[model samples]
Target: MRIAVTRPEEDAGPLKARLEALDHEVVMAPLMTITPRASVHIPDLPWQVIAVTSANGIRALPPGHGLTSIRTLTVGPQSLKAATAAGFRAEAQGGDVNGLSAFIRAELTPAAGPILYLSGAETSGDLEGQLGAAGFACHRAVLYDAVPAAGLGPVDALLRRGEIDAVLLYSPRSARIWRQLTEAAGLSAQAGKLRNFCLSTNVASVLPEHWTRLVAESPDEQAMLALLAQKGRSL
Candidate 1:
């Protein structure tokens, strides 16, 4: 199977290696570019906890910020791993923003100071809004920005040649970007011919109804890879 990976290059490395290990041809087609916000400042406050929905948020932290002493909470396995590797005491909830919010509500209270949320410029879920509505003070710091790619690179040729069998879509935004770019490149029909393996239903929902789509059992990379492996065997 020739699979196109649409995640940013930093996040796509492990997925690419995994797909290649499964004997699939992997095409690096990053639909978005991740840029760390250099001018952003971390607020000086008695933060009770740190929250991050994406690993990119953790990576975007300025060098020597010295926030590792604060307890960190992550949205899923990947973010948790990143936080842990960064020398912080971190824990992960179920693979979604709602679950992370629920975990915070259950574990902490408004009396426990504020939560510093490290995040990207645009997010699919409103973590701070959700927590704020629940009487929790959630301070969000935009640490990075994910800019959409204007065109597909190598994947364009593959789609045109009808050589791509599947596309790995990690987020709704990236999925939408892929759809828009392919449509603009006059390769919508070719792209629709391939199966799309999405990390979750939200990601899959962005695709056209006529295209074949497979969603992971859970909204994490491990589950996504498992779904791909299972489907690849049957194909």
Candidate 2:
């Protein structure tokens, strides 16, 4: 099976490895690109916890933060790995920001400490504001932004050849861009020729009107990958 990974490029390597590990060929057709936002500030703060949603955010962590200084929560395993590599240890993880918010409301808010969020400049989740409204003061550190990737060279050829077996989508931005890329790349005529549409929940909801949406039970790659494997590229 040939899988088209539509995550932004920096994140594409691991998904490609996962597909290859599963014995599928991965076409790295990253529909979106992650561009670090210039002039984004990383606050030097004594905080409650650092919440991270994407590895890109973790990768964008600033210079002065130490691993043991604060508790950390990540939205997914990939971000956790990146956080670890960035020298931030996650004291709690697993839930998306919603669950993390619930956890904070239950546990951290009572501690009455400040929190810092390491996040993309144009992020999907707003854990800080939500937590703030719910009575927690969280400082945020904006790190990166995602824009459409450039030059879909072989993607055109692959679509023309009808070679894509699965379309793997991670974010709504990517999903919308996938539709745009397909149309701009002139692959709309090949609709339904795709064997499956594997996407995380938010991404699935935003897919073009024409694409079949296979929902992952959760937003993590493991969930999407599990859905992709179990659904057997026939969605």
TM-score of each: 0.96, 0.88
Candidate 2 matches the true fold with a TM-score of: 0.88
Q: For candidate 2, lDDT tens digit of each residue in 1-235?
A: 7877777778888778878999888877877667776666555556767777788886755455464456678777788888777666675464577777777777766355777777776666678788889887787777777777665657778888877777877777777777777777778767446644544567666765566678888767778778878877453
Give residue 94's lDDT in candidate 2 (0 to 100). 49
Candidate 2, superposed: residue stretches over 4 Å from native: 65-68, 233-235
Residue-level lDDT tens digits of model 1 in 22-75: 788888999999999887889889999999999999999999788999999999
Q: Tell me how candidate 2 scores on lDDT.
A: 0.71
Off by over 4 Å in 1: none
Q: In candidate 2, list every pair of residues with a backbone clash.
A: none
Q: For all candidates, what are the clash counts? A: 0, 0
What's the lDDT for residue 89 in model 2?
A: 64
